[model samples]
Target: MGIPVDVISLYRKACEHDTALSGYYNRNVRVESDDGPVMVRVPSAGAETMDLAIWPEAALLDAIGPHVPSAPRLMHANIDPPFQIQEFVEGALLDDAHPAGAALPDAVLDDIAAFFSQLLAVPVGELPAAPSDWPKDGDTASFAELLLRLVRSIRDRGDQSTARLYRDLGVPEDPCGLLARRVTGLSTRPFRLLHADIHRKNVILGADRTVFLDWELALCGDPVYDLADHLHKMSYLPAEDERITAAWAQVAPPECRAGWEEDLRFYRAYERMKSAVVDTVRWARLIALAAEPQERRAYAVELADKLDAARPCWIPASDTVLTPDDIERAVDRWSATGGTG
Candidate 1:
């Protein structure tokens, strides 16, 4: 869709007010509108340079708004030069009160489970259509294969420098192939909406309600995969993890929870392996974008840390891990190559 003049004016007003809020993929700006305060969310630089999303978030919200009222209300959206104006949510972040690794309060846990149940309750027929290549519901094997294919796509489309950096870090060229073999025997479950990236920052704790943010990463897939993703990213304490798992199972239907316990590890592994690939490319880009020596080094260090965290998932025992010096050299080499990150 073409850009609206009013939208441009709102963006200009945000810039003039210097009200841009920090985010990874978008610059969220707080601006005044006739309706009151609203947030204008515009994509960050090069957001479409990679084909990473399975569905457009605005469309998803438009379809599922009535089903999941806890999500922010989407006021307007545009595809080309993409931007979304949403109701300005007011609340403390879930992380602010219950930091990573900390067990959430009981009330908060129940609230989160309620959110998941409601989200998963959305009728498949009512949601945005999945990608043409997406697997049919309950096809766990095909779902796993599709994820591997996405990682392969990222590797193929990414710069050779990023590929070389992975090799230097001892990440196997075909870890996805290995991962495919290991993730077998997963039980099929009815497909439903999954808020795949539901970590601390994505949740807001309001006075009377808990609001989930960033529907951009939502997918239709195994319900267990959603739980596994949440567990892996949230890093809750072991006891708390068990409680949360039980809570999820209690609320989710039997079809959705079937064989979840056995399959959780495989899904977690997938999350880690994919993170290793995605973070490498992103951190390399950040390093390239850094104008100062220290900033570049900082991003390089973060890249190294991300790889190290995922080492068990993507690196082979036969291969040696990349050292800090190795990471620094790789970053420097990639930066010298001068391609737009």
Candidate 2:
């Protein structure tokens, strides 16, 4: 189907009015379409760091929408400028209402579990084309190795200027080596579609339905990793965390949930280790580009928090943990040395 002319028109108008929201990967604008309000999303092209996508998100959404009702309905998509128009979910973000470390309502928990069950049930052939090197279903070890390779690629391409700053912040010389060694012993499990990135911001709580957004980070892998990723990002209360884990296990296929109690720790550690690498590079860029004192300090504080969050996964712990004040001082010293590349 051709991209709707009217939607394109609306998108242009939205852009002109400066209503576009610049997120990490896309610039989104809300516009009214004939069917109802829709969101127009244009890719940020080169501005993403954690995107470990093997398939185009639009194709993934189209293939899974029938099975996963929580996924947003694709209204129209264009490749020339790389934008997609999806049904704009009306309501609030799950984060806005619940926030991190808060307990979720029972209904919301059920909704999350249902989303996972439905997505995992989709046959592999039904989804979009994956990379030729993509791990075969049930190859948990290969999948883990693939993640390591992809993250290593990101690190290699990262700015060399940030290397010194990362060291100063206690980031290990090589963060993923331990994970690579550990994944060798991963037990085999049936693989299926994993949302891969499902934090509160990606969820919309509407009047009638909950919608999951942003499939750019989706991957085919052990379903247990998805649960681990969710737990790490949401920071749900300990009680709620246990409840959600139980709920997920109840609905998940037994084959998919096998050895989850033990495997979950490995995946969680991988997530933390991945964060340390990604956050360091991102923080360097943000710190270097920051224009105002307040903005620079805010980014420094965020860097501190992210580093602290990933501290447990650091293979060899740094000399000392970094506080916000420590980070700010490091940033200043690093900047003075012309380390901002």
The local distance difference test score of each candidate is 0.79, 0.80
lDDT of 1 at 176: 73
Q: Estimate each model's TM-score.
A: 0.86, 0.91
**Highest lDDT: which candidate?**
2
lDDT of 1 by residue, 33-133 (tens): 87788888887786643324678889998999999988999988876657888888878888888898676898888887898889778999999999898
TM-score of 2: 0.91
Query: Per-candidate RMSD vs. true structure?
Result: 3.2, 2.4
For residues 1-341, what per-residue lDDT tens digits would candidate 2 score against the true structure? 76677967877856665766566787778887677678888887677566577878788889988888889988777787678888888889999999986778999988988888887789988988778878887999998887788667766664455666777788777667777778878889988888888999889999999888888888888899899999888888888889888988998887887788888989888887777778776686677678997898888888877788777766785547677678777766677767555
Give lDDT for model 2.
0.80
Candidate 1 residue runs with Cα over 4 Å from true position = 1-12, 15-19, 48-52, 79-81, 101-103, 284-305
Count clashing residue pairs in model 2: 0
Clash pairs detected, candidate 2: none
